[model samples]
Target: MPPISPNELSDEQRPFDEHVRQVMGGLRTPFTSTDESGALIGPFPVMLRFPGLARPLLEWFTTVTSGSVLSPRVREVAILTTGSRYGAAYELYSHSRIAAKIGLPDGVVAGLTAGQRPAGLTPEESVAHDVAAHLYTGAPLPGALYRSAVACFGECGTAELVFLIAQYAAISMVLNAYDVPLPPDAE
Candidate 1:
């Protein structure tokens, strides 16, 4: 079973029963890809079903993390680091472009993909990368890394880090569960 399943709960169409819709925002795309139909899971139908319910949340998440909180550079680092942690091919492939665009060092990106310690990392980026890896590995992040994140982000930034991590991790889980493949044109 998924850690959280949108399928199990029927939308009462009630405002409170709209966690999925809230997460999805006002997205109207079909639950699955148009090319083919298969088992459905994760944040699809909820989006396709109620854009009014889903749109706001989708916008909230996108705007908050990617647009406002983390700089494009930091955002790309966090995402690519998380993708590397999980060995999620789609995430890695997708973020590589974003990371490059944001000027993330190529060495750091490659090191993350190989699961090796990278050289020439700033303290903040290093902490975030390590913490993300620790999360995926089920190992407790060391006190030093946590302290480093606190030092780098301060209180609010640290909170945003957790939020960003959880969001991406949720996304990865959904993709993996559904075996969501990259689009044919993905590059």
Candidate 2:
């Protein structure tokens, strides 16, 4: 059972004021747009219970997913790696589609789902995969791995990689502990 029932308050039932609009507005993705009539779904409705916390979480998530130093593909790779490691079912379900929408390779997603490093990753993807794997597996980053990641991603990008790992790890914990499920009709 879900740890918390999703907030079912309609937009009209809730404030739906300018602040809510702005916060929700910032959460759009290429595949998910809140401007559309029915696009506010997934963890969002669940988060409505705590607007104060949700505001910054949504804002930061938007910035990380959209404006981070990491490429969208790399970001999704790290997310998928963490989601798979934790067996966060909702994370996998949601991010798999996002990964495909962002043009991560089919084989790569498949590999991540199966907890294996998929073949045919670009050099950048490989670095992300390796970094995520090291963190998820609780292994130290070997000197060569660290140097290569720094070389590929630069210092800031490398730092963001670690941050993304930690962030997604927390996200997975929330989804798993709360038993967040795939949205209705999602396969």
Per-candidate TM-scores read 0.65, 0.77
Q: Pull out the clashing pairs in model 2.
A: none
Error of 1 at 105 (Å): 2.7
lDDT of 2 by residue, 33-73 (tens): 23234434545554555666666665666566555788889
lDDT (0 to 1) per candidate: 0.60, 0.72
lDDT score, residue 121, model 2?
Answer: 82
Residues 133-162, model 1: lDDT tens digits: 777776776888788888888767877876
Candidate 1 TM-score, C-alpha based: 0.65
Residue 111 in model 2: shift from native, Å? 1.3
Task: State the number of backbone clashes in model 2.
Answer: 0
Clashing pairs in 1: 24-54, 25-54, 25-55, 26-51, 26-54, 26-55
Which stretches of candidate 1 lie above 4 Å from their native place?
1-60
Displacement of residue 101 (Cα, Å) in model 2 is 1.5
> What local lDDT score does residue 162 receive in model 1, on the 0 to 100 scale?
69
Model 1 residue 86 lDDT score: 66
